[model samples]
Target chain A: MTTNKSLFLIPKFITTPSQNGVGRYVCQLQRVVLKFCKNHGSSRGIREFIEYDLLNFANKNPEVVVYLKPRRHRGPVIKAEYLNGDDQIVFCHNNTREEIAKWLNLLRTQSGNHDGTRLRKLWHTDYPSIQGPWTPYTFRDPALNLAEFPNEELSRPLDQPKTATEELDELFKKQQESEVAESSEVK
Target chain B: MSVLKRVQQWATFARIWHVYDATWQNPFQSAELLKKYLMGIHKPIYHPMNDCGDHVIVINSLDIALPGNEWAKRVYFHHTGYPGGATWTLAWELHRKDPTMILKKAVYNSMDGNLQRRYTMERLHIFPDGNVPPELMGNVSNQIRQIRPMPKRLDHYTKEEVEKFPKIIDYPKDYILR
Candidate 1:
C-alpha cells in the first residue's frame, strides 16, 4: 500500500511481454464489436464504414473476430477486446467514416487497454550496463591488497609544498656554490 | 536472478573496511573525515535509507591533537537524572580517563541525531594505539589520508643530519650560556 494517492489508485507497470514487439509480432486484439442502429442519423457513418471497409478489415486480420449488432434507436459504439482479459469501449456517435476507421486501427494495434494506468519508465533494457555494475574494488589500486594497514605512505596527505627547513637548505647550497666559484677564480 | 547477477548485487553493496591513522591529527577534523566512511557517503550507491555503510578502524587515537586551548575549554556534560547530579568534564580530563574517548565522542557528535546514528557509530572501531587485532586489521582494504602532516621532532632525526644542517649564525665565544 503506497501513501501516494495516484500510485495507489492507478496501477503502474513496465513494458512487459504484453506490450512487446521485439522479435515476432502478435496481434493482441482478440475481438471487436461494432454496435449501431439500423435506421438512425448517428449510425450513418458507421453503416457506411461497415459497407465499404468492413470486408477489407476482416480479410486483412483473420485472427480477430468482428461482430455487428444492429439495434433500434441506439447510438453507434465500437468495443474492442484484448487477449490480456481487458476491454476498451469507444463511442462513435456521429463520427465520420474516416474517424471510425482510424479508431478501429488504433484499437487493433494496441497490446491492451493501457488507459487509467501509469507507465513506470519510458524505456526498458535487458542489460542495464555495458561494462558492469560498480564495486568497491572496481577503480581501486591493486597495491592496496598487498600493502599493510596504517601505512605511512598511504596515510599522508598528498601535495604538500616545501617547508622552511627545505628552503633554507637550498639557499645555503647556492651560497656555498657561489663561494666555491669565487675561490676557484682567485686560484 | 542468476548466480552471476546475485554476486554482482553483493559486490555493489559490499561493506568495505577502511583504516585511518589519527596520529598528530585534530580529533574534530578527523571525526568529519571518518564520519563519511562510516556512513557510506563515499560510495556511489549511497542512500539515506539504505544500509550501505562501511566499517572504519581508527588507529593511534591516543596521539590526537586538539586546537589551542580546546583541551581546557571544551567540556563534556552528563546528568544522572537526579537533583544535584550534573557533571561537566574537561576534554583533557576525559582523554586522560580514556584515550579513545575524545575521538569517539568527536565522530559521534559529528553525525545527525537520527535513529541510525547509534548503529552507524557501532561500525567505527577506535584503538588507543596501533595495536589492532590481526583479524580486524586483515579486513581493511582502504586507508583514509590524514588532514595534516605529522611534524618530525628534532630528537627523531639522526645526530649527523642535525649537524650537517645549514647554520644561520655562529655563536660568539663570550656569549653567555642560557
Candidate 2:
C-alpha cells in the first residue's frame, strides 16, 4: 500500500544531460576514478571493460576524464564526480565486463543527482505571457469602466433569443403597422 | 497569494493549471491565451528548444464564442489528398459536429511551426464538458479563471424572480399581451 507517499516526494528535471552545455543541462560526470585490486576476483570485470571498451568510450566522449587505480586485496569501486560538485560512489563486486561497461555509460549520462526529492512544480518557464499576464482589467472593456454597476442592459444576457410567442407577436404587430400605412396611402 | 510570492515563483517554479470555462468568450482571443500557456511563453524560463512549458487543461469548450459574424464567416479547410476530397467547414457547423475541434484547431494553428510543436501541444488537454478524469486532476495545481463571465442559465431563473425584475415601460389597461 502506498501510504501518503505522494506528498513526501518532490519532482524535478533530472539534470537534463547537458546537450554540449547548451545552458540548460551541465555534464554531471566531469571525471570518473575506478579503483580495483590487481589480483582480486571482482577486479576481473573492471579490467576487461578498461582493456576492451575504455579506449573507444574515452575517444567518443572526450569531455569525461577517466582514471584507473590499482590497489591490493580490496574490492572494486567507481567514483564519479559531477560539474555541480556532487560525487557518486558505486561498489561493483562479482559483476561481468558488460555490466561494468554499462555502469560507466550510466555514470557518464547522469547529472549526478539521486531521485525522490520534492518537486515544487510540474512545469517551469523563463518568459511568462508574451501577450501579457491577465489581471482583472486585462480583457475588460473600457466602456464598462464608465458605466454604472447593476445597470439593467449590461446585466442581461446579450445573445438571448426571442421566445416563439414573442416572435409571433412581433410579426403580427409588423403586419398591422404595414396595413395601417397602406390604408392611409390609399385614402 | 501575495504578488511578491507569485513573482518569485514565476522566476522559479510555476505549476500547470486546468482552465475550462469558455462561455461567451471569443475563440480567437481564447486561442491567443491558450498559446501563451502551451509554449510556456508566460514564464521567465521560456526557450525555443527547451521544453520548459506547463500543462494546460481546457474544459467546457463547447460554449466558446466566435465574435461578430465569425460563426457564419469563419471556415475550416482540410483535404484527404484524393481528387475533390477537399472539405471546407464553417465554424458553427464544426462546433455542431464536434465542440472541441474549434478550440483545438485554433490552438494548433496559433503555435509556431517547429519540430517541437507536437511535443508542446501534448501538454494541452481539452475536454468537451466539465467531466475531467480522476487521473488528470492530480497534475492540475491551479485553476485559471475564464476571460469572459459565464452567462446565466435559463433554468436558474424563477417566476417570482422574473416578476420582481424592474420593467422599463407600463402598458395601458386596454392593451392585450399575447
Candidate 3:
C-alpha cells in the first residue's frame, strides 16, 4: 500500500453573528484537537488540504471514523490526506451543523443519533439562546452525497438553496411558548 | 461587565504605524500579509528583541465581519464531559445570540503566536454597540480614525470610460498632474 501525507486545518474559536455561549464544549475541543495535533508528528507530501478533500474521502471509505463528540473522538488521526481517502479523518470542533450533516451522511441517518456516531450529539436539544433549530444551509460536509440531495427542489432554475429559516423561527417561537407554558404550569 | 483601564499610552515615535478595526474585522481572517502588517511586522526594526507597541482600538465590537459561507455552516464546540457531553453552535447563530463574542474571538486569534502579543492585544477596546469611547481618546481624534478594511479596488478603467476618445487619444499638448 502506498502511503500518503497528512495535513491540518484547525480553526481556533468559532462564534456567530448572533451572541451565543461558545459553550465550554467547543472550547475544550479546540484545546484538545490543537494540543493533540501540535504534539503529533507529521511527515511531508501532504497536498490540497481542505474541506473538499475530507468530504470526498469520507464518502468513499466506510471504515472511516465518524466522531460527533458524545462517545467517540473523530479519527484516523494516524495519517490524513486528500488522496487515498486520507481526508476521511476529520478533526472538527465546535459541533457545527455541517459537521453534524457530514457525520449524518456518513452514518446515513438523520435526527436519530445512535450511541456511537461520528459527532457527539448534544443532550440539550435547546442550544443556548442562538445555537439551536439547526440553520438550513451549510458549506462543509465531509459525507454529503450530491445524489442524495433534494433533486425536486432543484428541478427548476434554482437561484439559491432556500432554507427552512421560517420553520426554524417557528420552532424557536414554539420552544419559547412551551417554556412559558411549563413555567405557568409550575407556577 | 466593565472594561479594564487603558493602562498607558506611549507617544508615537516610529516611521510606520498600523491601525486595525477588530470590531468590524476578523483579525485572524486577514491574509498572511495583514498579520505581518498588524504586528508592526514589515518594519526594518531588525532585531527580534524588544516590543514595539502599536495602537488598535476596534469599535462596535458587535459587528465584525466574517469570511464567506462560514457564518451559517461553521460551529464551535466545547466538552465538559458530563452526561451532556459536548456542545456545539454555529458562528452565525452566535452573532444572532450574542454579537460581541465574535470580535473578541477575532482579536485573540489575530494576536495568537505573537510574542508579548497578550499585552499588545489588551490595548484593543471593543463595545457591544458601534460606539467608540472618545472621552478616553482626548484630542487624539486623528488617532482614533475609523479603520476601514482595505477594499479591493480595480484601477483599470473600462474601454468605454477611458480618455481614448477619437481625437483625445492623440498625444496631449501638455500633461498636468493632479
Candidate 4:
C-alpha cells in the first residue's frame, strides 16, 4: 500500500540478449568485488560468508572473477559487473551470511542490473502468434469486398417482424379460401 | 523490428471506414450504435487509451426519425460570453437550420465528456443525403444496418399488386365511388 514512485518510475523492459541455457549457457556476471572493513561490526556477515561459503562459490562458477577489498572502517558492499556493461551495487549493512549468499546467487543468474527496474510484460516470444496477428479484414465477409457502399440489402436490419399490413392480408386470404370451400361443397 | 512485423503493426491499427443509412432510424438510438464504431468499442482490441477508432459516414441525416414528441420537446441551449446572449433552440428548429446537427449532437452527447471527445467527433462524417464525395465514399468498406425497418407506403406497391389484394368488404354497384 506504499505510494512510493521510485520503483514504478524506473524504465521497464523485457529480456533481449543472453538467451542462455537454450543451446549454450554463458554466465553474464563477469566480475564481483566484495568490499568490507576488517574490524567494522556491519562486516560480520561478509567475514562469515568469506569463511564458510566463498570457497564453494568460487569453485562452482570459475567464470565469475571474485575480488575482496578490505577497507579501514567502511560498511559491507557487493559490486557486480555484467557482460552487458551493467554495473550494480548492493549495500549489505547488517545483513546475515545466508542473505549475502542469496544476493550473490541472484546477481550471477541475472542478465543485467535488473534491480529497481520493472518488467514491462510478463511474457516474451519470438513468434507471437501461430495464426498470425489480426487485421481489420480478418473474419470479414468476402462478399462485402465486392459490394458497393450504401447497399440497400446491407442497410436493412437483420431481424424484421411481420407488419400489420401483411397480417391483414394473410387473414383476408384465409377467409376467401374458407368461403370458396363452402360453395364448392354445395355444387 | 523485422519487415513483416512492421507491416503487421500497420494492419492491426488501420482505421476502417463505415457507412450507415439513417433513413427512418431514431437519432438517439442510432447515436448509441454509432458511438461504438466511432470509438472502436465494437472491436476486440478496443482500449480507452488506444487510438483505434474508425471513421463513420452517415447518409440521409435528413430522414432520421425522432421518437415521440422529441422533435418539439427537446431543447438545445446555447450562450455567448456576454449577458443576455443565451438562446434555446428546439430540436426541429435545429434540424431545419442544419439537417445533421440533431444527429451530430446526439452522438456528441452520447459519449463521456473528456479531452478525447472532441477528437473522436472529428472522425464522424454526416451528410444530409447519399451524395457523398467520391474520395470519402471510396474508403467505406462496411455498412451499418438501420435500427428500424423502413415503412412501405401504399403508393410504393405496383398497380397490379394493389388491385389483386384481398378486400374485406365490397361496395354496392349503385354506390358512387369517391
Instruction: Please name the candidate that would achieve the greatest DockQ relative to the true structure.
Output: 4
Better of 1 and 3 by TM-score: 1
Whose TM-score is higher: candidate 3's or candidate 4's?
4
Clashing pairs in 1: none
What does candidate 1's lDDT look like per residue over A39-118, in tens digits? Answer: 99999999999999999999999989999999999999999999888899999999989999999999998888877777
Q: Model 4, stretches more than 4 Å misplaced?
A: A1-13, A16-18, A39-41, A160-187, B1-9, B48-50, B165-178
Q: What is the DockQ of candidate 3?
A: 0.01
Q: Model 3, range B1-178, lDDT digits (tens) per residue? A: 2232121112222322223334345434532323444455544342345454444444455656676877887787768889898889899887787776666566566666766667656554545653546554331211222234333233554766433322314556686756
- Predicted candidate 2 versus true structure: per-residue lDDT over B102-133, tens digit per residue: 98888888887888888878888888876778
Q: Candidate 2, residues A1-187: lDDT per residue as tens digits?
A: 6688666765564334435466564556899998998899988998888889889988988889999999998999999998878788889987789999888889888776454675555565656568655432344467755553223344343455776645765776687799999999999
lDDT per residue for candidate 4 within B1-178, as digits (tens), equals 9998899889999999999999989999999999999999998889999999999999999999999999999999999968999999999899999999999999999999999999999999999998999999999999999888888888999999899887768898899998
lDDT at A17, model 1 = 56
Cα displacement (Å) at residue B130, model 4: 2.4
lDDT by residue for model 4 (A1-187), tens: 8777864647676775756778889999999999998999999999999999999999999999999999989989999999999999999998999999999999999899987876767888888779988888899999999999989999988878888789988898898899999999999
Looking at candidate 4 chain A, the ten consecutive residues that score lowest on lDDT are A7-16
DockQ score for model 1, please? 0.58
Task: Sort the predicted structures by DockQ, highest score first.
Answer: 4, 1, 2, 3
TM-score of candidate 2 versus the correct structure, residues matched by position: 0.44
| Models ranked on TM-score | 4, 1, 2, 3
DockQ winner between 2 and 3, please give it.
2
Query: Would you give the TM-score of chain B in model 1?
Result: 0.93
